[model samples]
Target chain A: MTMPSTPRPGGRSARIQAAVHQAVRELQKEQERAELTVPAIANRADVTPSTIYRRWGDLAQLLADVAIEQLQPDQPPADTGSLQGDLRAWLIEYFEEMSSAPGRAMLRDVLGTPGHANAGKCDGFLRQQIEAINERALARQEVPIDPEKVIQIVVAPLLYRILFANDTPTTQAVEALFERLTMPTKT
Target chain B: MTMPSTPRPGGRSARIQAAVHQAVRELQKEQERAELTVPAIANRADVTPSTIYRRWGDLAQLLADVAIEQLQPDQPPADTGSLQGDLRAWLIEYFEEMSSAPGRAMLRDVLGTPGHANAGKCDGFLRQQIEAINERALARQEVPIDPEKVIQIVVAPLLYRILFANDTPTTQAVEALFERLTMPTKT
Candidate 1:
């Protein structure tokens, strides 16, 4: 959640981080997880084995880090003036990204890490984005929906379908839920 | 979903199946997945390695089978007369079972197996139980909710929390969903 030991914006550190992550992205395209070892990744990234070991611990951790990097939001949620507009745009984009093949693979990679620390981090990232949307709604003098409800009502089913790698809902389906959430109800 | 190669009824085949399944369960409790090889399992089950090799092909398939065996429903869904009664009873039991540590481990085991065929099987098992509940409602002349709706409203959130391996909801939260699903609505 707190960046998971990622190096901050800099010269050499940033360059190496990008190189190593890019190396993983390419190697994973050809090799299975078991075959993608530290030395191999180090060689591909043009770094020594000890550098990877000191930074990421093992392939499992590195894969988790790379997947997390792919999933992180590079910008804040778009402000659409109304909660309905804001949530619909945000969630539809999410549905598109996460329902894609690479997104699904990254999700599995994050979840497959030992102790599920990456899963927690992924969850944190989602929750933070939802919180931002809710804050915007509150500032706009509109009632904000509960972030927990968003997790249950929207994120849950969306992710369930993604994880199953089939039976994913149409964008319109998630849009309907977004409409339902922003509607005035007896909550 | 369709038993996936499980031997049916009583016979030597069933005996062998039970012995192997039990051996896998016992070994899994003590050892990590990487260490539970075919020879080790055969030795523990008092069977031949060739027997396991011929039957299950490899450790991944065997582990999937054992997890499936452990997850299969041994009985039909309970008929509580009303949809509310039936769904609440079923969902609460599922929430309890899947929230436990061993249950979570078993879920990860099934999902971890390559290809995610076992995930589909697990989904089918759950859907069957829900279908049974819905059929009972129809027979009783009560309105039945859609099974897909049940997947979205209940199973999705339930499995999402279970998969994350932490922050599972309280039993009351799931019971409340069961209540909501059975409530009269303008669907």
Candidate 2:
């Protein structure tokens, strides 16, 4: 079962994938992901079920593809010069995106879908985003922070609030997370 | 709607609630919460759907009640006497419970259910548990820590790993979380 990261650029295949993804999102807005059917998505996308089956193998794979595509940052991480500023900006952007309708829908699809090991796939995407920001921090000569530590301290709490508590992290909470991570401590 | 903190005292009502809660957990073990229907649950519990509706109003409320019941601690907090010891013991207990099949099932039911405001319900339950622990810490004369901060630092990270990352927090990681929370910090 192959999972295409993105649609092939400027071709018939690209158009098909785009339509399929759009159809999936629209269906998701109206119904639960588990209620989504391959034939229904194909009918909406104006493609054959066989085409979808051959491409994505099943609903889980198709939804994963759409979720990943939606989660990709619109642009590279902004250079905010300091590690604290950069981390704060990245996290706030992430929080805002995750609290939006599309982002929550994507998360619900990936997470709520049963029998799908989409969590590992989503974690990889999240780690890559953090690594990119860390690279920028390193470039600015800041002491490199542990990515795992960062995930536990910053990302995990925010995500817990988003997914489990269904609460949006306030700006103060976001800044507190950044401060707790970046502040120098007396061991 | 009156949400009983505990199942009503020994009587027909208690027996019914117990049977229904058991049926809910069994169904959750076999399938996702969203797929659970009132008829199926009623059949399993040997009660009529109207009975469930009368007591809980709907599937969401019934599931919420079951989830809350499963999450409530049976015993009072263990007093390890010291703040560090108490925190460590409490966290380890929580981690083990959350990593269990039943705990994960309850979480999936609360989180995976669409359009359910179960998050707030779960959060309140969690906060009550934390307060009970904090009360013990206060009795031992340790300065009371913020329950929300404890959640963000200790609980959220472990839960995020369990739910999203699918990675179990190691013993060292758990200890690190407790230490981070209890250690005196320079503000």
Candidate 1 local Cα displacement, residue B21, angstroms: 3.6
For TM-score, the strongest prediction is 1
TM-scores, one per candidate: 0.81, 0.76
DockQ of each: 0.41, 0.41
Steric clash pairs (candidate 1): none
For all candidates, the clash counts are: 0, 0
lDDT of 2 by residue, A1-187 (tens): 6655555698888899889999998998888554689999999999999999999876756876788677766666677876667667888888888877667767765664443366667777777776777677677666656778778888888887887677777888788887777542222
Task: Report the lDDT tens digits of candidate 1 across residue range A34-141.
Answer: 477888989999999988877776666678899988888887799988777787888988888877767777776776554667777788888888888878887877
Worst 10 residues of 2 chain A by lDDT: A178-187
Q: What DockQ does model 2 achieve? A: 0.41
